[model samples]
Target: MLDRRKILTIGGVAGAASVMPLARLAHGDSTENGVRNATSHHHHGGKVTTRSVAANAAPPLDPFSVPMPVPQVLRPSYRTSKLDQYVLDIQPANVEIFPGFKTAALTYGGTFVGPTILATEGRAIQIKYRNRLKEDANVHLHGGHNPASSDGHPMDVIPAGGSKVYTYPNRQPGATLWYHDHVHHLEAEHVFRGLHGFYLLKGYDEARLNLPSGEYDVPIMLRYGKFDEDGQILFSPYDDVSTRTTFLVNGRPQPYFKVAARRYRFRLLNASNHGDFKVNLGGREMVQIASDGGLLPAPVSRKEVLITPGERAEVVVDFSDVPVGSSVVLESEWGPVMRFDVDRRGFDTGGPPAVLRPNPTLPKPTVEREIRMQLSDDQQVFWINGKPFDPDRVDVRIKRGTTEVWRIYNDDSDWGIDHNFHLHMVRFRVLDRDGAPPWPGESGLKDTVSVPPGTSVRVQATFGEHLGRFVYHCHMMEHSGPFQMMAQMEIVQ
Candidate 1:
């Protein structure tokens, strides 16, 4: 077994010296600490001696050869009249990620990717989260409609060995949501360490639609990671850069799922820290039934879906015509992600509904906001509207329950890459992208949208009952930090 103390020391050393300098520059602070630390910073808000790890000492772990393991859906320990409660402990463990190779990883509930939380609309959820690791962390229910207190604001951190109860009033419609670490300056490192899980909200409207259920409904989470010679996870401390090489679906690398010759509902989430997947289903047409927020008005067929970090899409694939002994591979631009082996035949009575859900009528905009995403000339820093994330600064303030149009511009042409725009607590509709109507998959409600370089996208939303301070930022975790592309908003009465 690898020495826990030694690994901690090595991680600290590798992060502190190399990563902290950029972070300090971003935050305008001399020192800070969390899970990923540098020589100038500490860990879990404690002082620790730091050293440097030789980058050339270890060989990189092979991305292939590990059979995929399907993630297990988490069952709540108990339920009450008004609350569904769960307990999660964040800690470190060693698992066989590669064949016969024990890779050290940080996990939630003692798994590589945390357990999936199945929730229902109108039911409140109370999660008692305990941090047993050696660093500070907190949980963010991404794409949730809840009070700011439970929004996992970066400033609202849980220190090492600390615990907190996060409440989510599941009042929104059925959607594919997720939870992960959201520490202010260390979100990238914490998430890259495997602190993410799915939170699927089931609603009466969706349940009544008679979509695929039980084993036919699958949740696929895509992520990438890097491993060292000793099979330990390695996180880069560089600015605007990541070291992801392996692709995983629901915590498994190139895993294959056995499916029946019928239609299957796949809830797809792009959970990578900084990568995007332009997924192609081996030339098979995928019917996209929903986007981030919920069901679309009608199902749209598409050949490919470009899912970036922090975005989710609900797609259905009909395999009724495939031979029983056939195999279908899902591929990204790089290579195959996973496979579906037709092992059985079953009657699929349900198909995509002609009409899914009624679109909410958005009131006239009472406020118009413009936000810009820019990268420094050197591409070392990211900024929002010419300003980096300032905890003390409130970028926008508005009256609660009012509709607004936010025009987000991605001005990062220096690197010629796209940036993702995301907001907390409320869902929005894509008014247009670059003056064109929203694409098929983007027509539904959404909390996150992709903004390509040199383009602007306009979105409209009504700020609902939840009031207080919330955030709007890039979904690329590495692009969100103390001095990165993020801003705060206040909803006033």
Candidate 2:
């Protein structure tokens, strides 16, 4: 999701700051201290330390493989919920990371990020989720291959104490996805409060990538969370809504990992509630191998990759030359993410693959169309195409497997709001920016891209082959509420 909560600034009030607290609107279960619902922080510290410490060290674990020793792990299940409650308090607490600083996070399972839901493509996933907080809530699977019933339809509230089961068949190939609250009125609050987790879809194609195996690739989710002076987590209230200052990688505030000094593959997910991140390995560059939908034609070597909320990148970093005790920091232009401390141990690692599986590119859009998006602000209303969202209306439709170009013009002329455009079903290649080719990092296929104020972007992609009701909209939770800032796409057979 992209357009976060929009802050309303009221000016010219005499001694307004000294006035008594206005009657706080009842949002579910707000703390007496007056907290508002807000999206969680994105990241902090340095880049991940998943590289090897030596050229001949044992490799890292493969996130795709579920070990036999832990075979009893829960298989994917189905469930649901209805928006009922409000004011949920998620704790962004600390956890041990061997020699690293205790990481802090807003979590439902006491971890920075939740566990992964392993599933086979083309199957049903049912989730019966409950909202224990004092406000309404909902959940959207970041990139689930499913139907509308499971897509967390906007404004479909799961009231506090209420529950809803999301049921949709998984139809896409292997990829790293995520799920988080998508409540219409209080999305920022719920997600910022830690109601998100990772969801993985495994398929036969990924098995053929030949990039890394058994103990070489890992899924590392990067997010940020905040805490209060009282040692409890600090969440955004409707009034004080904005991104936090601190950053986090995989739920840790500032953690480090030990490496054997070999080549390691990392699947990076920018799960931040509302932060634009340019991931860089301290002073070094990265070989970006894949993006949202899966592997690219081959690795694209670049120094920095700017990942927005709900975006993912697959990259390989070689740490075989770093000396023991020397540490490498994974950082972004925004803040440091995490550290990789190379150990004396070493191992012979496999080199980068020359030919990776590439998505079959369809012919250019035979039916050319343009979408002009505007992030305008009125007294309290936000819009797309100068109109609010209305479920009665089906925004766009396309035939299965047809390619098209979506030109998004961010007309923040009046309001100039930063908007993140997220589309469902197929991933898209950023064709150009201001009519020119995009940067290397921006050239890959993606599910979400931020349309900064006063700028425009064009994306080319095909629709899923399945017939169903899918959606495309601004990911900013607050901007996308009832009757405002959202649209739908129906794929016909």
Candidate 3:
């Protein structure tokens, strides 16, 4: 085993230029227009500076090179009010990713990837989080409908060696939510070092649907990162655009899972710092039962599901007819994600119900706003509506319980690149995309939506009971963090 103490002592290097050229050298892919302007104005004291560089790429690890390791399903060690209480210790440790390669990692509860927290609706949850690393960190329950105190605002951070207790009134319906580090400026680096996990919320109505359960339910957390020759994780402390050469599912590279010939439910979470996935299953149709918000009115069948970072989608796959001993692979544009081996025969009694939930009634709009996404000429700074993030400034003021339409446009000039929009504390409905009705996959409620290059997306939402301050920004970590694409909104009664 690798020495955990030694690896934890090694600090991460700062600056984007230090690791920019390595991606081109390793992948030979010139498509990525890396940070063209290496000099950032935000450097302390306004002095032009750079960090000493090092080799940041390891030999490419082929997918399915090793058998898949199913992540251990975590049952909360404590619970109350039908809500689970977990004590997560965030610290640095070394994990054996490949057979012989021990990679340095920052984990929750000493695991490379944090354990899944299964929650039920109408309950209350309390998480006692302890930050043991050298840097500040905080937890954000993505897609949660909690008060400002428990929402993981960037400014609400716990210093190293400090602890905090977060309370969540689990009032939202069943959805595939996740938890990750959300410290203001260091979110990219903290998440890149492996500070993310799954939070699955169950509802009484959803349980009645009779979807796949027990052994058939699986949580697939997708992540991407690069490693050094010595197996240490390499990341650009100042750049969010650094390329990742390795892809993983539940912390393993190219793993395969053994499945019975029956219907299975897969809860997918895109937890990468960057990169989006266009997922398909060997040309097999997948029934999408829920998106970021929760269950749709009915299951939507489609050939592909496009999932961006910080997004979640719950899908069901029927393997009843697949021959035993046959293998099927789940793939994305990058390459094969993971393989599924049908090794056992079993009876499949569960199928997608015709109706999953009632469609929400959108109220008439009381206000409308437009937000334009752009990049600075030097491409070092990202802007939302021609302004950067200012914690002291509130860009928009909204009335509680009123409906509003937010028009988000991704400037076409930034071609070949797409941006995603995410709003905290509320689930929304996509009114239209590029003036057309939302695609089948986007018809349901969502907390995040893809704003493709040159296109505009209109979303409507009726602010719920909670009223305070929240944020809306691009989901691209690089853009939202160092580049400043985030903005604040105030909710008034």
Candidate 4:
């Protein structure tokens, strides 16, 4: 079940000698005032996708709920630089969204997503990260706790017009983090050829959780691209089944913002690299007060909310009742990507905070443990327990705060390949999928889950209570970095 010619061949996008294979697997162009040419390369391609979880027939305790209305916007600003960026051949012409089909995407700075670094938790960001595209870049800031050489270390590169001033000194607190291009094997074609960005991390309890501040607060940032008709950017080779038609919230595409119905405050971010957003609200009703480490002690009004690509939700949409012009959309999973028009002018009735301060939910765990995740694709050595990702080795370990019951299975029906299981630092509680239990608007709390392939999910957490070393990989950012699928959680103390 593992030996597709030995699998593990990192760095792709040969598309016709277009080259950019992570800049020949990280050679060196160096930037950020140091290290000029170190070429190194020795991680040996990359390949891991195993499968094995067959208990079947236990699905349906209460799974089926969709309805999200909480819509709000306004809170995005980025335009900082020190130039010299260029990864390789370079791309990014000029686009806002919806033109001829191939929907604009080629970022490093021209935004598909690549700028939004507002920091202040511990302070010490530094940044110089340049790497203008073509190949070989490194930024990684997903959750950002920083360390491990400023984190982005897969093969770590800035080559191709090099740059790297990393720094990272903002230890926790504020949230909604992001920053991609974790180059290993060309991180899913440089994050679908758009890289990525959006790393806000303020602090002081999100400015005292007043909630909707400055323009009502907004940071949508969803993503999904698949262009090619002379538009340039079009990369996908982890198992290309291609299910993206075209969607992008912050990078525009179906974009159309113009709200004013009042109470807005949406910080939903499903930066899709492999797609899995069920987000709903064509009719409107979103409340969801926080996720991914922030707020939520009360406030849950769903219409649809599934976000799972590194995850993050913090809804609060109250459009008052819609009258001005009536137009409020914001769906994903393919169905009307971004719209918000409420016009009619002025209004603010208030209806969003029954309570939401720092409620990361906690009250159901006597000790549990169940992990049944399955996903297969014979010929190419892809697995989870069947074997593939072997970074030297360290499969699984836990002991810090102990609390288990993590079951996830997606028997890849031959070649469905589209995972995203991220765990790192703990955050679980799905409870059932093929056995039922999961509808208090999804019982709350989650780190990342998009199992779709065959289906047999199950979860319930408690992992050593965050000691350090963490990671639960497969967010499909190209098979979870370097297509190895990823896995790691050492919390032993």
Q: What is the lDDT of candidate 3?
A: 0.74
Best by TM-score: 3
Q: List pairs with backbone clashes in candidate 1.
A: 15-37, 15-38, 16-37, 16-38, 16-39, 17-38, 17-39
Ranking of all predicted structures according to TM-score, beginning with the best and ending with the worst: 3, 1, 2, 4
Among all windows of ten consecutive residues in candidate 1, which has the lowest summed lDDT?
A: 28-37
* Per-residue lDDT over 1-493 for candidate 2, one digit per residue giving the tens place of the 0 to 100 score: 2233223211000011100011011113211111112322211122211211111111121211111111011333323342212122233446432123443444544544655566666555565665555667677888765666667766566777787776646666566677777766566656755567766666666665556644556677765444544334555433222224334455444456666677777778876555545678866757887777666667888778877677888888888889888978776543446667787666754666777666565577856666666644544455666666676777787888788888888775344345678886667888888887775655556788777667789888877656766667776554564325677778887
Candidate 1: Cα lDDT at 371: 91
Compared with the true structure, all predictions reach lDDT values of 0.75, 0.57, 0.74, 0.56
What is the C-alpha local distance difference test score of candidate 4? 0.56
Better of 1 and 3 by lDDT: 1
Candidate 4 accuracy as TM-score: 0.32
TM-score of each: 0.85, 0.74, 0.86, 0.32
What is the Å distance of residue 147 in model 4 from its true position? Answer: 36
Q: If both were scored by lDDT, which would come out higher, candidate 1 or candidate 2?
A: 1
What is candidate 3's CA lDDT for residue 388? 87
Q: Please give the lDDT score at residue 239 for candidate 4.
A: 31
RMSD of each: 10.0, 11.9, 8.2, 22.3
Q: Over the stretch 1-493, how does candidate 1's per-residue lDDT look in tens digits?
A: 3233322221121132212222122221121110111123233333344333333212333333344565677777788888888888988877665555676777888887788888999999999899988888899999999888899998898889999999998999999899999998888888887888888899878767878988888888887656666657777644222224455677665667888999999999988766677788888999999889989988989899988789998999999989998988887655567778888997878687799987888899988989998765444567888888888999999899899999999885433445789999999999998899987799889999988767899999999998899989988776786337789999999
